[model samples]
Target: MTVVHVLLGLGWWLVAPRGAQGVPRPFLSLHPSREVTLGDTVTLRCRVPHPNVPVSIYEEDGEPKWQWDRVEDTAEVSVNVVTRDFAGRYRCQYNMTALSRFLRVSNPVELVVLDPNFPPPVMSLSPGGRVKPGTDVTVSCWSTYGATFLLHKAGISAPIQRQSLSRGNTATFTLYGVTQSDVGTYGCSYHPRGNPFVSSHPRSEVTLELEEGGPSMDHPVSQQPAPRPSLSLHPSEEVALGDNVTFRCHVPRKGVRVIVYKEGDGNYRWQQDGVQDTTEVSMQASTNEISGRYRCRYEILAPTWATDWSDPVEMVVLDASFPPPTLSLSPRGHVETGTNVTICCRSPHGATFVLYKAGTSDPIQRIVTGNTVAFTLHGVTQADTGTYGCSYRPQENPFISSPIGTSMTIPWHRDTFP
Candidate 1:
């Protein structure tokens, strides 16, 4: 019986036809590799040596695992619009009775479905008009098509707030602490996975104005007679160099000849003179020596009596050549994983400063310092390690300095000593 069993085993190995060898050919091929969007389809087919053999189709890593075996001459499988999870490689094999053979592994067909939607949703501020400073305002965003909306504020680059889809075709954004600087345009858009191919138009703009004390509309009219005769310097107020300074005065509306005088010891330096009813003049001062209080007055022709000088507006000019501000990292040295740190900037003169991570195009943070000139980071992490610097523009034209300061690296992990 042992000899007979040995003979049978030998027969099985020798007589059973060898499994198909070499590379099997693919009938159809997909060009790109895997990574398709949420709504795409793909097809795969295998080449058959002889026509009319049962060919079964199967998909690896697909939901529901396997589809019913397709017994056509050439097997073809189709995947409908895909989602994030649908990204993967797929191949087919031919099943032979003796042994199964793999056809050429089709080139990884990658499908990337973009949002396809351009220009996001439209957002409108209601009353659909401008809001007065310090007043509450409501912003609304609506999509002609899908839901899901993101709202971005003017001046603020990032999306300050977001809203989920509600019943109707619209979503509303509201601002309680509205200010005059927030008086620009706003935008909104939608992000949808399904049919992610549509976007809405941007809505109109809204303007906001600031009113000191109470609304400027409520101020009582001045009863005293206007007085302005001679030009004199107002008390000089100190100002950082590179800052925009405006000189203002009150001149009679009609029949008044106005001449601006810069206060200088002994002889008053006369500057430009004009007949137009001008109240304010602006100029960039280069140094502290140019600083002084300035006042203005007007006369009607030679013999006419000049009015009392208007209130003096002080101006003080500081040095303009200081180096650009420096950015400093708190807790100096390596940053441990998950540890927090602060990045601070100190500049004598700058309107706005933006902080960017090395190699990145967008700013990590931005600070608009009308008066205060510093940027503070709340929490620092390992990712915060890199070069840092800033660019600044003086109040007026001429030159905007190049980026100032050097770069610093922060390491997240520390080496342990044995």
Candidate 2:
């Protein structure tokens, strides 16, 4: 016997169990679908395999929230006033006496409720400047209140990414190996932590654009110095052991041969002759020994002229075995402008320490060697007020580094003194 059902605008054909020849699997459907606004009506209907069976609908908790007995094969429970508590997982099950009193349960469905009054989260893009192909970018959603973040791309009905945070008010989504297809407008909506169904308003959109070809300079092509090639790391310059990393070298012209060099080693790490202006080399960082500084140069195939090497880029593989560094800020509470403040990082082992400011990609300052590094801020201003973190690499283990430490915030005042 064949049983066909349609729910939520989609159709499905139900199949019977092998031993129970004519008993089709029980199914559940929702009226008004999974997501609904507050005060909306929703109905949960369960279609059982047998007629005149007892059906019960339950939430995530074991206790049944609703139950009904019907002579037909279907049982339904309706909610006239949908509240935040109604937003959760719901499933239905039925007991059939003909089948040895066995109970069969339907698949669970998620219910989301939107709150029209909640304000939207603010969305921002990382590498806020220019984005080029073969690079990774992060999109952040931040709100004053803690919530679950839903990242949405324009023209897509459902969210592309979802992140729930129990403590923080911010969520970040990273787009790896970005290409031309990644260029689009994105926004974010959030559901407050305790009330998962209460979605906030959508944030303003952020448009992403990729650099098409070679970079442009204001100076004339004839008067300027020979254009140098540029090198970039995809995903990130920093990575974990066993993670795959890609190195991209972009030249001013296509059909050129590119060579990437490793610092301190006379031998070139990789070389490629390609028709496209941008070429990429991918490898897995199996060991911390792979961490090092690198540069790339390009040679015009026809003219046989080699361009100067691009700026050095370092890859740091994080070693979780090392303890995370610690960050501290002086002038305990709030400091007035024009005041000198000290920020310090303490590590278990002496090495290279770096300081990072929140919301920015690159490190603000780095010390070549130290167990405890103190960074002094001269005449601190409003611009210096933000959260800061630190991390360090052991001198003996140059290739591996500790994870980022806890962050400390420094607030600055205009002029509190007379």
RMSD of each: 26.9, 23.3
Of candidate 2, the 10-residue stretch with the lowest lDDT total is 1-10
How accurate locally is residue 297 in candidate 1, as Cα lDDT from 0 to 100? Answer: 58
Candidate 1, residues 57-144, lDDT tens digits: the string is 3332231233224344666566675444443334444443333222222222323333333345555666545444546467776666
Off by over 4 Å in 1: 1-120, 193-418
Candidate 2 TM-score versus the reference: 0.43
Which digits, one per residue and each the tens of the lDDT, describe model 2 over residues 124-151? 9988756876565888888876456777
Cα distance off (Å), candidate 1, residue 361: 28
lDDT of each: 0.43, 0.64
Q: Name every residue pair that clashes in candidate 2.
A: 113-197
| C-alpha root-mean-square deviation, candidate 1 | 26.9
| Candidate 1 positional error at 335, Å | 37
